[model samples]
Target: MTGGTYTLLVEVPEATTISVGALGDQQFPAGWYAYTGSALGTGGFGRVDRHYELAAGDRETRHWHIDYLLGHPESRIRGDVRTPDSDIECAVASGLPEGPVDGFGASDCDCESHLAYAETGAELQTAVADAHRQARSE
Candidate 1:
């Protein structure tokens, strides 16, 4: 619907926040999070970025709802990239996170739209193992 940069920002479990440029300024708290959707929404990048901004005067930034609900466990942001082409959305739908996304449903990139999601510690580890298994099979 608009010409702009679109990217996904995921919060790695108590580790680090991985930003693909769509979300800016604010940082993601230590936890798993996946944001997929329009970067052109109101407040745009600021809205999503603020998700990680620890409340003023707070020791930890885990005061947000997502963080509180997740119980601040160790995890990582796990995801893959692809151009938004024919059937790309359907292909990535299964890759989305298990929770609600604070923004739109897809990211508009140069080659195509991209999708991403976060995973818990165990989930991240399992995904890694699965990748290895697939690699070995190949």
Candidate 2:
């Protein structure tokens, strides 16, 4: 599937503050994070693969706000909730709870933020999955 909306499930093993380009240094606690994004351009869902590489230390360039978090050695991409052939980035993000960082991935959109944080992986995953489902049904 390609050209869709996706939510990445990430885990931060330890607390740390990182500089997120123009967003400046933001504190991230040790926990799970869900980042929603759209892949409607040329490569489509292939963008998720690039994200995987970035999180795995196989890539270096930091192109997006999420890149800053993914680039950290302690952070990793666990899984993702994808809505193939759908474009509901903002809707899905809105359904989830607000994240710690403001304007994290909504520079081009009106979303308060596209990243959500949770105390556990299960909680984050459930929230992301439910958000996607709700967005898709709409």
Candidate 3:
């Protein structure tokens, strides 16, 4: 199994409010979002696939904070960046811009959030890639 840290690039078409599990209802502006997390569990990177399923409406279970956002009808998975065989989830997440929802996906760590947001896909994508590169070098 190939386990590592990964970031999911998400696009929200318009302003929307979604109840994010324990985080409750949170506002997400229309823009791009980057959610970072580790796939180091026994399931490995298969966790990423499950996220895709949620975004595609093929899955309904919301186990993680990211799942709640991805499950939203307006949320789309634009792309993803990955750093295989490494556990740099917090590093990469810390490198990106702060997310709207505090504690989103950082329940198990010290990070304020494992999610970040930007007004454009290009900006967030570039940030995600750079975060991965920076995390890997450390």
Candidate 4:
């Protein structure tokens, strides 16, 4: 679907630090991350597909903070939780636990950070999916 909010579930196999554009260097522990974002622009959810491409090493241009993490060969997109036709990016993000980075994926908004992290993939995925469902229900 188009024009919605989504949370990308990403996995980093090993701990490493990457420099996010303008955000400076940040350390990412090997685990799972849930990044929430909005797709309300002209292209809508096409942005999500582009993210997948970046994770797959098919795209090189880093347009967003998430791009930097996804670009790492060891980091990959595992899945996504979407709320089609919904505009609850902040709500969903707020519901998730705090992330290591202070402003990851939240340059345009006031969220502490749109990315949340967990020690395991299952924990992060459950939290991300539940957050989206809770936000959409509200």
RMSD of 2: 0.9
User: What does the lDDT read for residue 66 in candidate 1?
Assistant: 36
Q: What are the per-residue Cα lDDT tens digits for candidate 3 across 37-58? A: 9999999999999999989999
Poorest 10 consecutive residues by lDDT, candidate 2 = 1-10
List ranges where model 3 is wrong by over 4 Å.
Answer: none
Local accuracy of candidate 2 as per-residue lDDT tens digits, 1-138: 468999999999899998999999999989999999999998998999999999989999999999999998889899998899999999999999778999999999988999999989988788888899999999
Clashing pairs in 3: none
- What TM-score goes with each of the models? 0.28, 0.97, 0.99, 0.97
Error of 4 at 103 (Å): 0.7
**C-alpha lDDT score of every prediction, in listed order:** 0.35, 0.92, 0.95, 0.92
Better of 3 and 4 by lDDT: 3
> Which sections of candidate 2 miss by over 4 Å?
none
lDDT of 4 by residue, 1-138 (tens): 478999999999899999999999999998999999999998999999999999998999999999999998889899998889999999999999999999899989999999999999989888988898899889
